[model samples]
Target chain A: MYQLLNHQRKEKLRSPFWTKNILMNILLGFLGLYLIVTALVVSFMAAGFIREEFEGRDVIEVFTAFLFYFFIFDLGFRFLLQQLPALSLQPYLTLPVRKSKLIHYPLLRSISSFFNILPVILVLPFFIMIVCANQTGLYSTIWIATVFSVIITNNFLNFILKKYFVKRPVLILAIFLVAGCLLYFDSIGNAPLSGYFAAAVNAIANLPFLFMIPLIIAALTYYFAYHLLRKNFYPEDSQTTRSRPESYSFLNKYGELGELIGIELKMILRNKRPMSVLIFSILFLAYGFILYDDPDNHFNLMLGGFIMTAAFAVNYGQFLFSWEGSYFDSFMVNRVSSFNYIKTKYILIAFSGFMTFVITLPYAFISYRIGFVNAAMLLFNIGISSVLLLLFSTRNSTSIVLEKSQFLNYQGTGAMQFLMIIPLLGIPLITYIVFLILGIQQYAVFALGAVGFVGIIFYRPLLQIVVNSFVKRKYVMSSNFRKK
Target chain B: MIELNNLKKVYGTKTALSVGQIIIPERDFTGLVGNNGAGKTTMLSLILDLIRPHSGAVTSKGKIVPETDEWKNYTGSYLNEGFLIPFLTPFEFLAFIGSLHGKNSSDVKDFLNKNRDFYTENIDSSKYIRELSAGNKNKIGILAAMLPEPEILILDEPFSNLDPRSQSWLKMKLKSLHLEGVTILISSHDLKHVTEICTRIILLEEGIIIKDTKTSPDTLVELESYFSVQV
Candidate 1:
């Protein structure tokens, strides 16, 4: 166990991504610090915010009523972001280590997940502010313990949920449906689930020994995960059922370019990580509802337009070449031209932007301003952002494992992805702000569209530039990819 | 033909591979045999331009492999599973490779039919390449390499995971390809298969070619004695 723990530390420290790139490490460290500080501030302010929103009500009771909502949201958050703790067990499978120890290593190591830490950061402060001040020491202590027990229970429950959900994706929709039904029922006053939930939690404080119920629940969840993991410890045993081969012969008309796009589409659809990224991007289309409802916030509207249109390009194109890192050698040795390879990526990202823009056209029914802004942003994204993203992608040498979950999997991210986002999103917003300052804000949208129009006209030459960069960096990227 | 001129690859202070002036002529069936760290794979990677050497160059058919991609048109090689796309099924992967070589689906079907002996039943299944067994994956890779019918063919450890029958079938298939005037370069730890199928054998030790000779009946015995003495 000690050796396993030590190996885990070395595994992280020796990750070529971190060890070779000190700048990336520092950037990631700062980003992590920023997130923790933000969460802490939010938690500190949460009690007062709740009190203000629900005036004339008992603050403790109100907060306690919402604890059930918080746990459900935490579960969903973890389901999306938390990675199954992996130790590359293939090598260890053949070693002399005990099977139980091997299984326990990852399970125990998962307790240290940022998902686990986040709840503590976002809940502990509120609990201290509200429960500690209003109740006796013993009561508050047991109350906090009950909440933490559920939190730890959530950590284990997520493992089982993710494992099963991967095998049966319908379970994901079912879970959402169940949660939605609960919310609906609670809102219509058909069932006072939140009130009962708060009473149960209050009971733990009133009778401190009842905290054992949550503790036992946490223990049971841990045992369930252990049992499931032990049963399918071998790699082969955990293999999902084979996917049927889907035909894309309709794409044959465009010849090589269409074939390439078909393969790329299949890659995104079939793989876990890329598919999740696509779904996440599609979800951003709803941003218009939030931003467009308020007419005065034109800047927010532009931001929303940019996000909705370029979400796929920014998210997926950030790791453009890295997507094929697994089969990079085949590409090098095969007869596929680097120019065409890059052009295919450009076409896909641009098409995604167009498709998103069309889907969001319905927003124009609400207001024509929403339509004009999204249209300009869409053109900018497909023209400028797409080309710029593909150009910057040539500098990305980190190889992403497409099979892994995307939530916190920072496998292929580098300084280039982060730096590129500044200009890709910033240029349009900066152009808008400049126009607003010049007192000609209405024409700013057209100016942005004109710039993108020029980019669209010269796309062939721009793509050539990206291809040149890719050809120059091919050897470096290939070598880095082979490291894994 | 492929030519290696003063090829040298260095990993830190150690010279992983260094070869000077070796020409692999057309239709020459060359086998590279060596110990674990003998730099066999490294040399192949350099020949394919998968890695850039510290000094010197590899030229295929008069064009430098790194400077021009013309060589990729007539060269087919599979160094490892990295050459196979995991999400693609066997048929899709073969078709993709064929398309790169300007072959349509009909052409791919023809190629599959021609190599029916080596094409296993698993290739017809709908499973992705990642789901297939190691031997089946190796077969798909080998078949894809040969699908384009290039002048040059290269494989690394092609016989490792294959069963005995499949191994012999591949040996026969490779021998037939050599007979059809395809230049072949393969590295294998199995001395018997290499000696039987390859017309020439090159023995590498510690980044240097210690022996280069035409393979005769006694070549396997010589290799066995050399390896046993080292052990």
Candidate 2:
């Protein structure tokens, strides 16, 4: 089993999907490492805060008391991001490999997950502090063992949780709502869950034999996961997998381009990655509360203006042409002209920017400056940023698998996408900054709006340029999309 | 009519397609034949403007394929699964295709009814094109191209995944369309069907056209003997 995993890793590294654009891969790798190290440093800092708050009490008891919340937080995150055991186990199921051993492979693999190690990384230093503080070795050791057992228990519980929730997604929402209600009750002191947790932690430390509870829980969870995997490992029966017809006809009322937009909308709603991005774009509307709450910060307001107006554009536009990667060839050979195709994208995103602008009007009620700046930014994003994104999208040929979760997957992301962000967001922000430094700070907003209006006025010429570029790269894009 | 003038396409060091000069006249039932890697699909792609040639051009009715959208108004083609919008149902797909050529949903329904025999199963019940079996998916593609009643039709391996009954239905459909002077081009490895329906057959080997001739009664026997020698 270890050899099989090792071979899969090596084969994955050899695939062009991983090895392409070596420099970009190295940069993203470094960025990831930087984030992890920063998180570790933050955890180290948090350990000090814990000691200061819980002074005069045994640090082991306080830290152990907090361990339950940590496990809950980690569980929520792992549910969202931790990949299912997607490795093809079907091939081994046919072999002489024992079902017990096959199930154990994924269980063992789950323990090595980055998510399992993250909590350990955060809490390990706190335990070391307790050891340094001259606590009883046996008591400290029991606390440490209990925390690790809790982490392991959560890890195995995740496998069962995900397997069940995948078949019934509404159950996932219900579980989250229940967890939220528990936390709410505990917060309002209606339920003293925290006090109960602290008492349990003290019991585990004082009576070292009580550590057996979490150990038993961990063992049972692992057993449950094993049985679940064994029973549900094969493909679902055809009856359960049959798909019902789903139709969307709202956009058909607008004629042919409306039909195209309707398809695009359906694609976004139906696919996992696009749906997540769409949701994220909506959530980003709340960013203005953080940025514009203080009216004096012009810099933050400008930055917020860019992000708010262009939220949908950035999230949806980055994968503009690639979003249609699945059926791009069909579009190319169909009756749709290259110009009309580019025009349709421009109108769709421009309209999205307009809608985002309208939804953001409430921000203006908070502060007139935020309101006016956002209005200006909305114009700029629709006219300039959206056009730039559409033009750059003509160059994107990577075929993205729409089924996979988008968060941190980065499966179809390429160097060009990263580079395109500069022109899409950078130029407009730079134009605003340039005008601001020249003592025309108030006029800067209008300048940005004017530039955008100019872009809209000459939309035909701009679309022609995009159309030509799309035609030039059409063959390469089609061939690349065909690769997967 | 489609004309390929000094057309060439290469991927790195290998030539995928190279046609010095070729003309497929209007109303001709032409069949393209080749083994794997023989550039049959590549040639069809170049003609349909799915790929850009390294040199020269393909023109349909005196309009360059890439430079003008005029050819698309009359051209209906299905090269592979890439030409399908897999998320849409067959009914939606046919409707969308019909709309592109000024046909309404009723027109598409009429077309479906006209060619019900070509679809071996009830396609309207399927949720999406992706859920249908391979044979059904091919039926969707072939019928979609034929929905517009195009002046020019190109299909790559139209008979590949179809059942025998569907294949005969398609052959009959294509024969009638050919009689009505709708130009048709088909690429297939099925020598029997190609010989039966196509007036002309072109054989390709390793990116080069080795034979282009009118089909006769003995065309299938001749092709088998020729391939037996080549192998």
Candidate 3:
């Protein structure tokens, strides 16, 4: 298995002229360094949670809540990026590979996944903080519990995920939604369960047989995941059964562009992967409203939500190049108007921007009663923000070539992404800060409108210029997007 | 008719295609042949104007090729599933493509009814493209491209992800389409099938056109050489 993985990596790096792909590699390398630095900062923070006084606060509660949500995020991304693509192997049964062995190797290789280490990295610090701050004697039993914590947690995460993918994706998503509400109510947000786990940790550290409990749970979770694995080993049998009627065939409600958007939206709704991103977008949009009790922070709330729209568009739009994945050759040879192709993406982002505003609009209007002015402001901001985003997106699309969504690869790591951030939020943030500096509290609404007005005036011509540049830069864009 | 004038494209520090001037004969079913890095894809991309030529120009019909959308009315293609919207069913996808060519929704449905066997898998008719396999996804893409019934059709690796029986069925369908005067250009590594179907075959090597053989009984030996991949 190790050899096989090594071979795969070598092959990935084998393009002879990839030596010229150095700029991309350096960008990827910097992103790696950033993640490591972030990890260290988190570890230091977790170490502080070791203090005894921290226990009385919501430290453990917050930790568990975030950890559980992280587990959901992990599970959602895994089902999409990893398990979803592995599904293609089902049609390859006639290619002479042993089905059981092929499934076994992928599953076995899955155990060493890159993501499994993140929770452990993030969680261990809090446990350590709980230990060292109390100055508890380094009892071997307490140490044993930590090891059990890793196993039981990892096993449960895997089992929940494996079981989810085994079913139809939508049904799995439904199960996830129901489970989330229950978990929030029954555990994380519930004082009893949080206290139980916290106190259980303290008692377990105090008891002689406390080590045995986690071991038992760990064993059971492991067994459950393994059993699920065996059942899914023969995916070919499930292929024909996985069929469903075409649910997204709405002839109305779309232009050629709009229909494309509708169909794309439907896939996102039905699949757990893209749906997770959308769900988070909705939550954050609403939560922006809920974040402050102070009425004055409303402006900040709108700005924060607007900022998030820029971020989501950039992150989501990166996939457009790869969305075509392997079919790029067809796009290359077909009679698709490059102008229309680029316009479709612009329209998609614009639609998302609209959605972001519409979702947050109710929150803004009901609370502020700013009325039609606010609605118009939102529409304008959305248009400007989406246009700016696509402008940045066009540049990024040129540089970042997406392959099939890799299982563990989250960030695509291009200098253009870095470049996007500087403009995506920076200009707006600077403008907002300047507004504050200018004693402009009364003019915040007018200022946002002014920005929107400017975006409207120049965005189309800017878009035309950008699309023309995109045509001229197609070589650069295609090659860059296609790079390692 | 499509004309290529010294059409060529090269990536930074490496050449991918350098096809000297050549014209695709009017109404010919042509097959493209090459190795993994051969210029087959690059040549096709140039013709469609998806990418600009590093050097030359391509013209379709009497116009200067795709300088306008005029040729699109006469062209339809399926390069792969990426050209497809995953959330759309085969029926919906076909309908949308048909509308692009100014057909009614019923016209699109009529096309699918005649070609339903093209999507005969038991997979959910109601599900989205994200739910389909690569092969099944390809099937929808092929259906969408053909529904428009354009004068020119282009396909890349069309027979991939298909069972042998399905492959035989598709070949027969292509034969009929060709008989009806649809000019087809296919890029594939499947030599035997290409030889059996195409009236012309262009062999590319290392981004250079080494052979542009029109299919005739006398060219059987050249076809054999390509089948065996002997330069």
Candidate 4:
């Protein structure tokens, strides 16, 4: 087993994927640290509430609510890993391993992996701070609850995600939505599902029932997932096709790269996995509108449009390298230039960004656009920013790790996003702010153009630098691409 | 004719190839036999100008340095993943390669028509290259190299993934091409196939040519002893 694992990597280590993996992991570790720090900062900012409300709030309530939120978010991530039905669980089904033991392995693996650890580190301390502030004898109860919550959430989420793949995603989403509503809606004020757990904690104020939910969810999800792991469970099985002799005429229209890129395009649309992230990004856009809830604020309106546009581009553009997974080596041998490859990706970004623009146009029109000047400015920003995002993403491609697994999983994003911190949110801010300061908000449109034009020219040099980096680091990128 | 003069290569500090001097006469089928990391690929890459040598250069035809246009126009080569476009259908991949060799996609298909079974497979060319099986992928790569009908052909581990039937079919094809005076260079570790088909053999050890022989291995025992191995 170990040899097979190492052997798969042997060929790849010589490929570019290996170096990319190392660089990405280092970047990922740092990014996790940054996120934890950021989360800590945010929680710290909210600490004033804990100090003020310490006496009325039973600190145990805070613990329960924390676990509840963890459960809610983690359930999504776990499912995406298909942890419930992943290759990681293959041995348990037949190796005389107990089903419970087999299922627990993933739970254990999850706990050991950094994603869970980072969150635990970020949130648990806050829970402890709340507990200490209360001086309530609730230490043991909270610790147990925390452990239970992590395990159960991880397990349950894995199982549901596997189940989601086993079923269709749309169906699974509908199920989760309905279940989430039914489970907690009727008992909102009383906090029905969580209320009982809250009550248990209140009774002992110091009792640790936090761990129970995760434990139950983990055990139950495992029981069903393992039971369902029948003879080489392929989450991708339903998508597989039996070999058949077929015509090549369908390739005609694509010209040269067309059939290839077209087939790849079809693969992406069919996967529907990334669509989940697309939905999430859209939700994030809606949240932006919420941040600028005041409709009368013109500056806020423009700010919202820029963000909506930027998110529309970057969110979709991030997965560019991954979409070419496994077949990327083929790209090197083919005659397609790196320019065309990157150009095609930019086209995809533009297409998707256009959709987002079209979808949100009424919103933009309602808020501010009354003339072609406004409309054209918005269009230019959308087109230009999307192109710039692809250029930056080309550099980041060396750092991104796209896992060829059941969709909706963590894509091994790195501190690569830090590069975006200044550009994505920054430039738009500076331009809009400067324009507002100058009392000429309209001129900001030209600034957007200038920034974009520089980006276009800069992409050429960036392309040279990055493509050369890619050639130098080709072996590393290819290897890591295959590993995950 | 293909010529190698004091060709050398190094991976970091490790020597990969160090052929002192050799000449591949026109119209000869040469089999390059070596183990994994035995520098077969390095030798082939140097000859193709895919990688430049540290000490010596390979000249194709009569040129000291191969002009990329003329050299590429008349040569068809495939090694590992260097022959495929993963996003393309096998048909698309073949067409793309065919185009590079100044042949249209339809011309490529027409060329393969005489070898229909060879070109035919239980894979949809409309499907992406990533979707094809290894054996079928080999079929596409082989076809891409062959469709151009180049004056020279270089293949690496060409039969590794092919089924026995496909292997036999390819062996016959190689024999036919050799008779047409097309020079062929094949790199592989399979001694039986190499000795059976090659007009001449070059055995490599530690990146240097250890043995070059013209003996016909008409019998199994003679073949084993030729490489100085006790079987």
Model 4 chain A lowest lDDT segment of ten: A397-406
- Angstrom error at residue A50, model 4: 8.2
Model 1 agreement with the true structure over B1-231: per-residue lDDT tens digits: 899999999988988898888899999999999999899999999999999999999999988888898988888888899999999989999999999888998999988888787766755677788888898889999998888998999999999899898899999899999999999999999999999999999999988998999999999999999999642
DockQ value for model 2: 0.64
DockQ head-to-head 1 vs 4, winner = 1
For every model in order, the TM-score on chain A comes to: 0.87, 0.85, 0.68, 0.62
Candidates in order, TM-scores: namely 0.88, 0.90, 0.74, 0.70
Relative to the real complex, the DockQ score for model 3 comes to: 0.37
Worst 10 residues of 2 chain A by lDDT: A235-244
Q: How far is candidate 3 from the true structure (C-alpha RMSD, Å)?
A: 6.2
- TM-score between candidate 4 and the true structure: 0.70
lDDT by residue (A382-440, candidate 2, tens digit) is 88887789888888888877766645667678877889988876776677679778966
lDDT (tens digit, per residue) of candidate 3 on A1-484: 4654564456456744245556666765787567656765776675355345456564544454345455555655555444321434544557666666555555455555545555556556655665445545654346536444544456455555655544354566576677657666765456445455555555665675666776677666655665555566565444444345444456355555555455456555544345545544544554454453444664655455554344346556655554443334444444456666666777777667666656555554445633334454455555565566566655554322232232333344446656666765565566667778887744555666677777667766757865777566555555454443
The model with the greatest DockQ is 1
Docking category of candidate 1 = medium
